[model samples]
Target: MLQEAVDNFVTSIANGEMERSGGSRNTIMAYRNDLGQLCSHIQTLGITSWPRVTHEHIGNYVRHLRDEHAYRPTTLARKLAAYKSFFRYLSQKGVVTTDPALGVCLPPVERELPQIMTTEQVQTLFQLPERDTPMGVRDLAMLHLLYATGMRVSELIALDVEHFRAQDAAMQCVGVRGNVRYLPLTSAAMDVLDRYLQHGRPHFLRDASETALFVNHHGERLTRQGFWLIIKGYARRAGIEALTPHKLRHAFAMHMINSGMDLGSVQELLGHAHISTTQFYCQLASAQHR
Candidate 1:
């Protein structure tokens, strides 16, 4: 019966319930998976029914996810969100008297000031890409756009050829929440992109109908894992430890803020819906000057 309830909940998520409510396919799947994990954990507690699960049981499950599963804080936060939503649904249906996941404080997440590369470090990293080869040209373009636009890695990989306004030297980046914004590219970045499009992309193109701006060797759109490997390789080659694509984004934000760009403009450029999110870079830039 417990498994039946869990399966029904997952089915609801998969059957357009969440989709109609603005949840993406990825998001709905993630919630289903997270809740499934929670249900599995509950079974281990010898509880066969949802009503038998107490608030304390949910707390124990959270601790189990943290200690035994070694889930990261961000991941844990999402799992908690899933738990809350699921329990709220159960409560509304009279399956449970109260929301067990409610009033449960999340583990504190450390908001570390993002790491950023120095201008010299960025220059060194950019030089490591082998521009003589197709893959090299592609890497150069990806890396250049990463730093030039401060876009999230997901946004970078999702870009299509049409997204680039080559005449204006800008690219349109799509946010996870469906917000779209244009990011201006540096002349140097634009030059590398032009070279990659003309010389590199055609070499990797296996399908004439593919529209992804960047493609892997398999001629498919690049994945986040693939880009992570690429960035890690270049960072290692540049002799920079702990550098990530996100650090490049941080570098872009810091550089812009330090170069006298206004906070509102930086917020817009970074596609930050909140000014508070962009303010952190200002603090990072201030610390650098100090």
Candidate 2:
């Protein structure tokens, strides 16, 4: 059956009803529903069986839940746990050649970081902006994009519309001596960017000729100082007097490291020219967790 594994995976965590997984009965039921929804989704992609599922398919499903349904990080984490269990069972039974859900990354757990914003603080700052106003929309976009990309403030302000790839949900960053890197956007960042591009940017544009993706009240490319003020304004409102763009970048790097992202991947995402530059985050994460 196309949906057989979804059903079997319910008690698969325990191997059978007699054995017990630490998860409660309700969690097993929730896992069953989660896998069932995923199966229903993939079948629409013309797959007649679970054996055809790929890592790409699982990634797309996660992105769909993120971008289309706007699932929160905690909710996504639960669904990912369900996927991992179901796929583990599938792989053990030879129903699939390999585990397709092995690569799905859940959010870094909430933890205390010395001299860094906690996950709750970050969420507070992100949710502080009022999205209805043009400036607010732009601010939220910048905040989300900055946190999502871990880009320097100068780089963020330097972006043009052409640098963003809407279909892939990524943005290009040009660094020293014309070095170029493309960074993937989080679904939250993508959603805010789309809203800013479609609704907010128009209000700030004095001329159609302006190509800057982010603009100030005068309809010109935003300066680093301008971005500084915008961020400070929000931070002050949130009672965070010491906030800076670099702090956000630091949080992004260390959180990824602590969440088990490889150092090479972190280096690439941060556009660090040397792996050595990215290695400190490992120590930093350890220190924070300690």
Candidate 3:
């Protein structure tokens, strides 16, 4: 029965249900890893099915992850979140009558300020992508768009040509709950996008019907992994450490605040559902000024 539950979970992932539910591949993999360990632990306790698992079983599993495996608080919290989500999924499908992982206590996670690149570092990264070649031009546009819009990499890759309103100098992105937010494009980013469309994108266009704003050599929409590789390659060339999309996003917010953009404006531009989420960048901006 343990195997059956695991199989069902695997099937859900394979069927693209997770992606349809707005889960990224990386996130789904992390959930899979966390739940796999929990299933293994449950099997040792003579529990085979999710229906037979009780809240006590889940509580012991958390303690085991904390005490026996010496998992850090953040790791423990993430694992418990995966367990709760999995049990909730099972309950919804009638595989379990009750969500055994409900109301489980999770370890506290200490918040850390997200990492960001200095202006000098960003300049170096922007200069690393060669301007004379198609791939380089594409990479440059991607990097500039990321920094300019503060778009999450997921949203960045999901973009299509129709999303951009060139006449308005704006791009509309689908945010939470299918609501759309239009972000004004900076002159520099707009110029780069124009160059990419006119010169660079055509080079990669294998399919004339492809609607993706960014495409690989095969003319398919760029995947998140593909974007990560491109960013990491440039980061290494720029001699920057620990650079990521989230770091660039933080950099965008902090840079905007330093440049006198108000917090509320930045929140709206970033499509943040909560103003408090945008306020964290204010904290970073204050720290930097100090």
Best by TM-score: 1
lDDT score, candidate 2, position 47: 91
Q: Write the per-residue lDDT of candidate 1 for residues 186-287, one digit (tens) a residue.
A: 999999999999999999999999999999999999998899999888877788999878888898988899889999999988888899999998777777
Q: Please, what is the TM-score per model? A: 0.83, 0.60, 0.82
Tens digit of lDDT per residue, candidate 2, span 27-88? 76788778889978988999988878888899989989989999877788889887887777
CA lDDT, candidate 2, residue 161: 95
Query: Which residue pairs of candidate 1 clash?
Result: none
* Position 19, candidate 2: lDDT: 30
Clashing pairs in 3: none
What is residue 127's positional error in candidate 1, in angstroms? 2.8
How large is the C-alpha RMSD of every model relative to the true structure? 3.1, 19.7, 3.5
What is the TM-score ranking, best to worst?
A: 1, 3, 2
Highest lDDT model number:
1
lDDT of 2: 0.84
